[model samples]
Target: MKLFDFNKYFPDEKACRKAFKEMRDREGVVCQHCGSHDVVWLESKQQYQCKHCRHRTTLRSGTVMHGSKLPFMYWFIAMHLLTATKKSISAAELQRQLGHKRYQRLVTKQEHP
Candidate 1:
């Protein structure tokens, strides 16, 4: 089961942003137009606007749940618990934790990458 404590997953925005940044930086973002790694972060917008192409890319772009219904915090909690537990949690477990019956249907009905 998720058994996630939201406070544990997203205790603060800074922590969440730091974790997200680390993951995002693991494979540094490259400009789609020029293949340049140089970029700048816009705090107000929370997106990276490539210094090369000036393209605006969202932190959530191209992620596994790009268009999924799962909240970012929930996803983060799920991932953390799954990794920490080192055991696969079933949909029913996640469904219970999420408190959304529709999630079970979505998890079952949709395909995951």
Candidate 2:
């Protein structure tokens, strides 16, 4: 078995989209509203819909990226960096590396004030 690399391959929306589509298809997408396989793509927003209940869900919905303003590549890079290190990197370090001020503030508020 070969380990998949995100930085070496998926570094953009197109790659992420292709991988997500394949994975979603393989695992099958369940409607967030009705838990049905009958779904449609919303296109402009990169979301899926439940034909039975008309519920729309995003690619990042229920995912780690849910409610994030960061780009898809940011998550990929962060994961790759985290796995490459041994001693464990702090959120401050990760935030500085990724240059995400939002997360920086988020972690800061969570830890201190």
Candidate 3:
């Protein structure tokens, strides 16, 4: 998608989170601990609770953005930049484009080199 189109679809962090949640819901949320399909979404907590194991799964769990504290918009924009271009993007360049101050936030040590 073009930059304009991406901006149109994801205007803010809330939109990105909503889109991510929808995608996750479509893929189905299974309990990682008990292997159960019976999961409930706790909107207030922004997590999924397994009916059998009573385990709580974060929305970012089992996804690429797992364990990340950055805003959802950051991930969406980074993904858009990576796929919307033909050439490969470096970690530093991606950080620059995202206007993020920290280089480590965008890539791991193994990925940076």
Total clashing residue pairs per candidate? Answer: 0, 0, 0
Clashing pairs in 3: none
lDDT of 3 by residue, 1-113 (tens): 89999999999999999999999999999998999989999999999999998999998887777667778898999989999989999888898898889897765333311
Instruction: Evaluate all candidate structures by whole-model CA lDDT and list the values in order.
Output: 0.66, 0.69, 0.87
Assess every candidate by TM-score: 0.70, 0.67, 0.87
Per residue, candidate 1 scores C-alpha lDDT tens digits across 1-113 of 34446467577656766677678878787665677789887889988888878997777665665456555666666566666566787766766765756654434232542
- The Cα RMSD of model 3 versus the native structure comes to 3.6
Query: Candidate 1: TM-score?
Result: 0.70
Q: Model 2 lDDT vs. the true structure?
A: 0.69
Model 3 global lDDT (CA atoms, 0 to 1): 0.87
CA shift at 37, candidate 3, in angstroms? 2.0
Model 3, residue 55: displacement in angstroms?
1.1
Worst 10 residues of 3 by lDDT: 104-113
Backbone-clash count (model 2) = 0
